[model samples]
Target: MSKVRTCPACADGAAAGDSFCEGCGRTLPSDIRDASVENPDSVPTAPQVSLSGATPGPEHDGRPGLVPEDGPPTAPQVSLSGARTSGPDTLATQPMRRDSVPSASGGPSPSTETARSGGRTATSAPTVPAWPPPATGSVPVKPTNPDLCSWCPGRVRTGFCESCGRLQPRGRDHVEVCAPGAVGVSDRGLRHRRNEDALGVRVLPADAPHAPGAVVAVVCDGVSSSPRSDEASRVTAEAGVTVLAERVRRGEDPRRATGAAMTEAARAVAAIADSPGSAPACTFVSAVVRPDTGAVTVGWVGDSRAYWLSGGPSASASALLTRDDSWSEAMVQMGMLSREEAMRSANAHALVAWMGADSGQIDAHVSTVTPTGPGAVVLCTDGLWNYYPEAVDLAAAVPGAGAAPREAARRYVDLALGAGGKDNITVVVIPVPGGGGPRAGQA
Candidate 1:
């Protein structure tokens, strides 16, 4: 006989293989039954797609608009911005350039000026196209809703409604990327109408001349206060991931590749700026993971961070690997204040370094670690970390090491939402090779 399950929403009995509760028509808990048994071969699978959304892709299986059991949600119909549904798209080679440049940030100044934050002196400069720099090209993204006007049938353009002049959700209000060796999720959070955050992740195969298989994950958080911040973050992340993947595939050192990637990303972002005073800006962070060697190299410009979550007996203890280039962190580093006190100050989150046309001296910091055991690498924007700022606490909250990267990342996003997601949240989870069991010290 088939088993029965209780619906969490309506307290009604749901028969085996039922996906929706008959009583309330609500989605049944995923554990109710083996969905595959209902339709063994009808599962939705990701097809080749592109970031530009110019090519046609496969449609989702099952009911129209309904998300497949194991697949990410599909984009709503009538996407004005032409958002693509989440899928594993091909990563194309992009040109990259390398050069030394200055990076800096502080208060929003209408004109170029010198400022000191966290003891770093920087002067804003005009946007230029020449500074030599750097896509995991065309990873698909799924938006939360359509950009239709509520008052009329007209669609939303850019951000304003076409017929009623009202504001609507941006194309990237929500996004998910499930690559070969890593997975990432980005959401616009509760407090932000626009998702000023972006992500790019790719898994490179081992067929390259002299390099091992690797996974590249990049996250950028746009300076929300700046104009076109969303565009800045998106371009920066795309450039970083694309350039890093190419360099790694060419057998370049992870550190040098990371710095080179940052330079290119900075140029990409700077190109969007109208002037130094009104430049779009964002924070950048990346992780390059080589499973063969258990090597993880991290690179960063601002506060976005990478964390090592040791899961097995052989792995190193979970820890934060990158330092923030913020006023509060600088003060703490200089022995001017306690960590708690520095964080409490009003200017705590003021950025001392960032990527933009105006930022002076685009100095990228790189760190490397080779773990002996099993673990997972986490790359995230401040949105997720602002809630669980400590490494131990974050490691305790994540799923077991054996969990799939996509599901694990989904859990983190859900946690942030439950805790009142106040900022745009973006997170990527890349598992270290050879993890044989559950995550270590998981509470």
Candidate 2:
């Protein structure tokens, strides 16, 4: 004869032998029912059985005791022993909802355990940092044509400035028929009444190479003190350049060609001197470059000079060649007087040898210099060098002249003018072919 119990869920009275409530179909509290029937005297007191501070019922299947059904709803006394609970109060703080719990079927529900156990609290979403502050000031923009000449502005018919009539080198009117690699600059200084003292010409073979490295530069400076200096300078430049080109075409050695050219120039000056009302003398410097072999050969008479400049401590205006038919230079070299003293001597301008019939002996000094590396050759009359007291000063001006050949010439002329150009001024800049390296075929 088992005692009966009431279901907590439905309050349906059930027989002790039943495992479920007949009215509500809820599961029976087996532990509570069993304990009540087995030990009547051991009935839990109200104070101990109440949910406010309840005592546990008998253990079943090694689980912690559950509260008696007759008492107020109490929390189950969870024990160290392994046990699972399904009471409403036991799951009150859990995240899982009652609907989310699986039926009797053995599968997990969609319940995620809260991460509050290890003392670490869960955080919300993350944020990104902002970009750095804007720049302090605006960036400067460079002009597109930085090399444009300020003096000769805008386009003109002859590639010269229409406003000032200044000739622009490499302008549309300037012809570039010289050897492809050959480039130079020429200009007349301010003191000259006429710019005819300076002459430059390029003569190409019938079948000339398209590249610039094979060009020849012929530069002649007329004697300002002489009446026919302009014509003498022109003949020397034209004849010398032509003769050199003819020799190159004939496959003659560059050194020999330079010598021949100098001879021809002397003859041309003499022919002029023989003409009526002709100046007896003119000064000239000529250079022929073979880019393929990196060779430079030069010839000179009078006080004109040739200088080689390179990219080292030794890169200076090394007077590879010069002509000193002038009395001052000869006096200094002959130990008659110191160079400084000779320069100021009364007979400084008097010449013993020059390109004219009156020169008595037409002696020319031809010389060749192999560059230490990439370098430049400068040929000029005393007009330009007189102002440039130092060689480095002249070297520094080359790159500043920009790509405009005439601009470079203008720079030299302007410099000489500023230094009080007392006579005709002329300058020619010839860039050595190839990059920085030892040159071949140079003496």
Among these predictions, the greatest lDDT belongs to 1
State, as a TM-score between 0 and 1, how close model 2 is to the true structure.
Answer: 0.54
lDDT of 1: 0.59
The local lDDT score (0 to 100) that residue 28 gets in candidate 2 is 58
lDDT of 2 by residue, 359-412 (tens): 443335555544433456667776676555334456565553213344455466
Tens digit of per-residue lDDT, candidate 1, span 173-253: 556666657778776665554567888876676564544558888999887545567778888988888898888878898
TM-score of each: 0.61, 0.54
